[model samples]
Target: MRRLLVGLIVAVLTVTGLLALRAELMTVEVEQPEGSYTEVLVAADVVRENADVRAEMTHGLVSTCRLLVNADVVEQSFRAVGDGVFAFRLRPGLDEFDRRELRGCLSDLRVQHLRVHVRHLQTVTPADDDRRRDGTPAAGRR
Candidate 1:
């Protein structure tokens, strides 16, 4: 009986050790690919409509855009650059599809008075150049 109990304990310890090792080895760090820093120009009418709570409206817009693109928003990226011009950065920049979707979603706001002009401020990165040379789409594109 003693021998059987010792064998069982040994087996349990072996299993536990294997599990710990497997867990350590299997841990993965998923680094989201960085994308473009885009600036969007909001229409004056839309800004006027939300003037009372402009900051909150901006946060909501950023949150909605983040969800729509399924990408991370750069911290403190939302700010007014000029009159009715707001800028924000998204990791894993928007593809054509994402851009269209974002436009459609934003159009639904403020009874369709919202107009946004999205412009990518940064030029293509070295990684993008490599990908283009390799004939593969950039990081977030289909």
Candidate 2:
């Protein structure tokens, strides 16, 4: 009987030790162009304690422009210029394009060393009265 109890305690200790070895985890809030948000799991190392990240998409004359910031995303906004390139305020002590270019296409934006998978969107003109006739509020119209 004593041997059985010892074996059970050893098994429990092994399980507890394994669980404690797991890496730190982090949660990410992803905001899409349509103003929808989703929570994603990421490594704790991706986001620092005070690091800021900001990303937004704007509809332009020809195509959509994606404005993103790595250091202070929450504090920056990009102007939607009629042309292809966008214009943003250069923060104090920060140069233009201080953020890294997200590679592997805009749909797959990897930020803060985390893989952020974004959905591609179809740009519907705001002047399309017929589209809003269905009573569904247009995205970002409000």
Candidate 3:
């Protein structure tokens, strides 16, 4: 019995030491890519409609825009800015062609009472100071 107890204590101490060493030496590194996106504001009567129906319309709009622009929609970037106004954030800032195409697509949604009279386009880019020594934006900066 004494021998068994000694062996068990040795095993427990070995495991505890191994765990402590692992805790001291383990390192975690996460790398995030830097990129730009565009902020767009859409104004239409459908956006200000009943809250329940408005959610459905917003989802449809986001899906439609994703298909039409061939761009990734920034996650959790859709929100209502004001009465009859909603905003969307699209990855990789839209160019001139994209802007024109987006405007045309929104106009085509007239049947849903979506009349986009105000389109606010803004580009988000990392500042110079945020760049790494190699001149690219640091990881997770975007």
Specify the highest-TM-score model's number. 3
Query: How many clashing pairs does model 3 include?
Result: 0
TM-score for candidate 2, please give it.
0.22
75-99 per-residue lDDT for model 2 (tens digits): 3334433222333321221111211
lDDT of 3 by residue, 72-127 (tens): 77888888888767788887655545655566666566347444554676545454
Q: Model 2, stretches more than 4 Å misplaced?
A: 1-51, 54-104, 108-114, 126-129, 134-142
Residue 38, candidate 2: C-alpha displacement in angstroms: 20
Cα shift from native, residue 129, model 2 (Å): 4.3
Q: Which residue pairs of candidate 3 clash?
A: none
For model 1, where is the 10-residue window of minimal lDDT? 36-45
For residues 1-142, could you state the per-residue lDDT of candidate 1 as single tens digits?
A: 9999999999999999999877644424343345443334443335446664554565576677669657676787777776666666666555555555565555556334344555433323447768879999765332
Best by lDDT: 3
RMSD of each: 13.6, 15.4, 17.3
Give all candidates' CA lDDT scores. 0.58, 0.30, 0.63
Sliding window of 10 residues with minimal summed lDDT for model 2: 37-46
Model 1: per-residue Cα lDDT at residue 84:
62
